[model samples]
Target: MTSDKSFFDFISNGLPGPELRKDADNAILPARKLAFSRFRALGLPSVKTEEWRYTNIQRFLKDSFSLAQEEGTISAEQLKLTDIPQLDSYTAVLVNGRLQPALSKLPAEGKVTISKLSDAANNTQLQLWFDKHPHLQQQPFAALNAALFADGLFIEAGVNASLDKPLHIIHIYTTTGNAFIQPRHLMVLHKSATLEIIESSVGLNETAIAFVNSVTEIVLEENAELWHYNLQISEKNSRHIYHTSTVQKADSRYHHFNFTLPSAELTRNNLSVALTGSNTETNLHGLYLATDQQHVDNHTFVDHLVPNCNSNELYKGVLLDNSNGVFTGKIHVHQDAQKTNAFQQNNNLLMSEKASINSQPQLEIYADDVKCSHGFTVGRFSEESLFYLRSRGIGEEAAKTLLVNAFAFDITDQVHIPALQDFLSEKIRKYVSGAINN
Candidate 1:
C-alpha cells in the first residue's frame, strides 16, 4: 500500500477540470482551485491529525472515481419508491445532484419560498452571503461541490414567517456507472422565522459503487428557529459523505437529528454549528446502526463564539457483525463566551465480538465562567437487562431486540412529528429483527 501522504497527494493532484464549471453569479472557480491546492498541501490526515485519527479516508482516496456532470433522469416510477410519509407538504427533489422540477411538489400557499437554484431571483443574497463566508470555499468537499454542482434547491423563509408544514428534500442517486455525485443545498431563514427541513438520500443501483459527496449550509437570522432531520439509506456498494454547517444569530434556535442505517462501504458525516450571537441555543442528536463490513463515522463541532450561548449533543451507535462505528465531538467556548453552557455525550453498543466502536467526546473551554462537560461510553447489551426480560417469558432473541430498541428510543422519540416517529420506530424494529436472525 502507498503511504498515506503519497496517496492523498496523488488524489489531490488529480483534481477535476474547471472547463465545464457551473454558472454562478460569482463564479467559484478561483476559490475552488485555491481549495484544491490547500487540500494537496494538507494531504490525508493521519493519527497525528487529531480530528481524523478515528475516521480514516486514506482508503477512499486511493480508489479511482470520476465526477458526474451530465444530468441522469430518474423516471417517475423510480421516484415513487421514495415516497416519504407525511410528504404532502412542500417538497424539493434532486436526482444525481440536479434539481428536478417536474418531480417536486411545492406548497401552493405558504410563507416558505422554494425554487430551483438556477432560477431563483436571489442572486444578490447569494453573492453577498458567499462573499462574506468564503469559508465554504476552503472546505475540501464543499469546494468540490461548488465547482461541480450543476443545480440544486434554494429555500428562503421570509421574516417572521412560521411554516405550518415541513419541507422535505429528497436526493436520489441513480447510478449510470461508477461515478461521484456532489449535491449542494443552501437554506436561509430570516429573523423570527420558523422552519422545519427534512432530508432523505437513497441509491438506486446495488452493484454500482457511487460516491455521494454533499454539502448543506444554513444561515439563521436573529430569533429564528429551525428543526432539521437527515436520514440516510443507500445501496450496499455506494459511499456517502456529507458536511453540514450552520450559523445562528442572537436568540436563534437550531435543532438537528441525524439517522444512518445500513450502507455499503463507508459513510462519514461532519456537522458544525457556530453560535455567533448571545442567547443562541443548539441541540444535536444522532443514531447510527451498521452491520456486515460497513463503516460509519459521525463528527460534530460546536463553537461558542459569543457570550450566553448554549449547546447539547448526544450521539449513539450500534454495530453488529464485523461493522465499525465512530463518533467524535468537540465543544469549544471562546474566552469571551462567558456563561456558555455546553454538554456532549457519545454512547455505543456492540452486538458481536467482532463489532467495534471508537468514541471521543471533547470540550475546550477558554472561558472560566462557562459550564462544559463531555463523556463517552462503549459497551455491549447489559446481561442483567437481558436476563430480566427472559425471566419474564420473553424469548432470547426477542429479549435482545427489545433492549436494543429501548436503547435507541431516547433519540427516536425526539422526533416530534408522530408520523415520522412511527416510521423510524418501524425501521428500527426491522433492523433489530434482521440482526437477531443473523
Candidate 2:
C-alpha cells in the first residue's frame, strides 16, 4: 500500500518489469514494456489537461490504496447481487478481474472461446490484438492499465458463428482494504460472426474504496455484427474509469449501449470506435443518472476512415442533488471518407439547483461530401410538465419520475433487449423516487 502523496511515486519508483510476472509470455513481455514506457512518458492527467479540464481525477486518488494484494473471493450468494431478472444468457463471473470458471456458465467451446487473458497468453488472437487500439495510445490510465493489469476476460468468436443467446459478464470487486484494480479484456469476432454481450458490475466492500481502471478492445471483421451493453451500478465506495475501443471492418455493424446509474462516487467512461473499412455502421447510446455527490463523465469518439460509413450517437443525463455530469462526443471524418453520414446529440436534465452539467459535442469533417452534425442541450427539470402531471392527480414524486422517464425515453427506447429495457426503466423509476424522497 502507498500513501496518497506517494501514489505516483509508488508506480514510478517501483515499476514492474517483465521478470516480475513469471507467467507472462515472451511475446507479451515486449508489449508490456512498451506500454510501461508510454505511461512513464505521458504520466497522469491533471486539471490543466484539455480532456480532463472538467474532472479533477487527482482528488479521487488522495486516499491511500494498495495494488490489490491478493485475489478476492466471492460466494454464489454474493454474486446474486448483480443478477438482472429474466436475462437468459450464459454468465461469466470474474472476481478481482480473474475469471472463476466454477461459478460461470459459459457458451459451448466449439465456435466461441472464453478464457482469462493470462490463460490465453499463447493464443494467436491474444498475441495479435493485445493492447492494439490506437485510441488508447494517448490515455495515461489506459497505458498504465496495459502495463500492470492482472487478468480479465478474453473472447474469440470464429467465422460464421452466432450465439443462441447473449453472454452476461458479471464483474465483482471485493477488497479487504482500499485498493486500485485494473482489468483488461479483449473480444474478437471473425468474418460474418454475430454476438451479443451484456456487462454489469458489483462492489462488495462496504468500508473500503475500490478504484478500478479497466480496458476492453473489440475487433469486428468483415460482415460481422456485435451488440454490446454495459450496465454500471456500483456501491458508493467505488470509483471507476473504463475504456472501450472497437475496430470495425467492411460492412460490419457495431451497436453499443451504456447505462450509468446511481451510487458510484465517480465514474468516467471512454468509448471510441474506428471505422477502418467501407460501408460500416456504428450506433452508440448512453444514459447516466447520478444522485447525491456522485460525478459521472462520458467521452465518446467515432472515426470514419473510409467511404460510405454511417455513425449515430445519442446520450442523455439526469443529475440530482449536488451531483455533476460531463459529456464530450467527437465525430471525425477523414479526407478519404467520402459520403460519410455522422450525427450526435446530448441532452441533460438537472433536477436540483446545485446540480450541473458540462457538455461538448464536436464534429471534424475533412471530406466535403460528408454530412456531419453535433449538438447538446442542458435544461432544468420543467416545472410546467410537473404541474401538468400534478393537475392530473399525480403525486409530486410520481410526477417528477414520469417527467424524467419521458425525457430519457428517446435513448432508452433504442435498447434492443426487452428484458434489459425493462430493467433500465425500473432502475430509472427507483432512482427518481429515491431522489425525490430524500
Candidate number with greatest TM-score: 2
- Give a tens-digit lDDT track for model 2, residues 20-95: 5744655777787789889878867778878888889988887877874458988778888888889899999999
Task: Please name the candidate that would achieve the greatest lDDT relative to the true structure.
Answer: 2
Weakest 10 consecutive residues, lDDT, candidate 1? 130-139
Model 2 gets an lDDT of: 0.89
* TM agreement with the true structure for every prediction: 0.91, 0.96
Clash count list over all predictions: 1, 0
Compared with the true structure, model 1 gives a TM-score of 0.91
Q: What is candidate 1's lDDT per residue for 1-438, written digit by digit as tens? A: 248555554445445555544442344546555655665555445556776676666566455665545477788787876776655556788888777768887776566777766555345555545423334544455655654555666778889987667878888887767777777777889899998888888777666567787878888999999999898877687788888888899999999999998765788888888888899999899999888888998988898999999899989898898899988897888899999999998889999999998887777889999888888888888899999999999998778767877888889888877777776777777777787797
Clashes of 1: 1
The C-alpha lDDT values of all candidates are 0.77, 0.89
